[model samples]
Target: MEITIWDEYYELLPRKELEKIQLNRLKRTLIRAYHNLPYYRHKLEAEGIDIHRFKTMQDLKHLPFTCKEDLRRAYPFGAIAEPLRNIVRIHSSSGSTGSATVVGYTAGDIEIWAELMARTLTGSGASEEDIVQVAFGYGLFTGGLGAHYGAERIGATVVPMSTGNTARQVQILQDFNISVLCCTPSYALYLAEVAQEQKVDWSKTRFRIGIFGAEPWSEEMRADLEQKLPIQAFDIYGLSEIIGPGVGFECQARAGLHVSEDHFIPEIINPDTGEVLPPGETGELVITTITKEGTPVIRYRTGDVSSLIPEPCACGRTLTRIKRIKARTDDMLIIRGVNVYPSQIESALLSFKELEPHYQIVITKENFMDRVDIKVEVAPEFFSDEVKTLEKLKQSIEEKLRAELNIHCHLRLMEPKSIERTSGKSNRVVDLRKKEGLT
Candidate 1:
């Protein structure tokens, strides 16, 4: 019951048969969307879309894409194809960038999400007897519920301890002898620190596989976490817009994440133009949810930079996979186990017009320490080209970075062009830890 083989049964099926199944599902979703949802029907009608005539997947490209803006404009429950009473649960984003994208799931949709998650768990060797501790927050957000249901589906004993209760989370893992753990990779590192602080015997614990997401992580960071916790850490990818983390997960091979393409279609396309790129070429990851019953998105541009691998996986799943994400196009920065965005810094920096937007962040290493330094060019007219004025500005910027980024930043105020500015995007953080020979 653990590892149900999907590829053996369906992988060798004719490509056209798989296409037919996908087409049938797409037709059902399209009909549900066109008849029940006002936003999609009006938009499709405006575009003169003959929904009936579009029979193939390529034909789907003719329809307009659904962006986060569309969800924001509609707000909560506007995109739902089913009645409110029929929805078993809701999931949402913070809308910090714009309006929050609200998602509803039918009872069946919840079951489907769980089934995919179970596949994630067991495919990674998580067993029914394993005590699974879910460390994500439970709410309208997708992270907690998605993993909770998946762990339960695999018959693993699930502990529903939500995020931010690090002490409590650590206590439960120590008390119950939990095996499989899930959380953002950053939080996992934080929890490991607590285990060290509390003098917990990590070796005596049953902890095994770690499913981590909600932030970008590096292989170096993974090694760091594994060294502390001494367990296999995995990268699970998902977005609230196109289902949560169950879309794909890492198998033992660690080569690439095997996506549930049979349920969700994965494609690498040009971010700006939406042109489909070749398999090996790097581009944005776009997902089309073919099997989702609620709020199915079509070619939703994920804005995540990565490459696609359509070849058969060694894990016995013929599903297409993607390489590790390089970075997000948005102004996001991860510093010392925290998610910091430029807007968070911009809001802090804009408190005074004395500072200019023409600033560069220098993330350097010195004396075996990870340091974040912000080198900025203040307005020339506001401050004379003097080191004293620069020092004053430096103090101001450091306070703001601490307040906004939640991490202390060494602020260096320089004369205009002290740090070169390009007409294009400038480097925000320069990580010099490796060049200095510090891991």
Candidate 2:
């Protein structure tokens, strides 16, 4: 029941004061984009938006929504508002397409990023006395460096164990007696398996806190990780386009992620119609970087599916909270004329105690129609020797899928440790329909 509030001045600011601060910073951000970035200027002009007339936060809706395509159109530095000389670092998405979405950070921007990350880590019960092991990948991917800098900022001893090297990662965790772990949830679970294989008892170690993000995960997975590792697992959220991995994070309260409203403004909108939905309504989460200097975005569509909770957090933070991301708009899968998300499938699978959290959803084209299949591994104790028992388990899984997904899907029961595991974000969906040009 311990609660730690980092940056009490900002984190505990009154709602009215926080909004006023957001408004002021937002004005400066808009002016910077309108005056420096031609893309924003042109878009504003085309929409007949008078930047000067933008007085209230409500006026932000009048501005056009910035999407990933717009970032792609702008390419490397086109969206940047600062001079190239002021830019200190650059990061781009690992998009498997043509142009990558590039983001720039000035020296000040980097400092702010580190500070926000510090808040994220500290809020998750990390402290200066703790040893943090960052397993996120470095380079163009922002997770590694973002968490790295934040750990450093908090004056914690950070083990810069990037990604991969599962054996080595387990060795560090054991030898260093790491107290804090920051990485994707899937990787955390994978590490749990690796640690077990290496005869490393996480409960005996100093491990106490886990900051997991960079991919969407379920509360079921969180419970699994916490129980498996005997640690408190928290969701830390951020995107490269929005100052990396410190845009917001879940406090010890664990109700929702408290956004750094002083820096970024969050809104939930209907993904299909672009209409701003009321608070508590599930929709696509949109954000505006109100304090970014290098590449400030206006109403940038995050494509992350979440809802805004207008009520104050029990942790006493006035910052707005957004429910954990359910699914991304781009991550949705259409199977048999039904829109499905991998989270839905994960939720259904996790409900079964006999099934392991490791599962995959596949959508392929069959005879001019879409076919849905789910492959889930059985827990070690739940594995059966009898064919009848296996078939019964499969039938039970299929029945659950049918009840949850409302459509028939092929169920492939896998043996323990049969499914491929990734050191980074887990690829849960395989849509062969897109490959067949049938989407």
Best by TM-score: 2
What local distance difference test score does each model get?
Answer: 0.74, 0.89
Candidate 1 lDDT (Cα, whole model)?
0.74
Q: Tell me the TM-score of each prediction against the true structure.
A: 0.74, 0.98
Regions more than 4 Å wrong, model 1: 1-16, 332-439
N/CA/C clash count, model 1:
0
Report the number of clashing residue pairs per model. Answer: 0, 0
lDDT of candidate 1 at residue 265, scale 0 to 100: 76
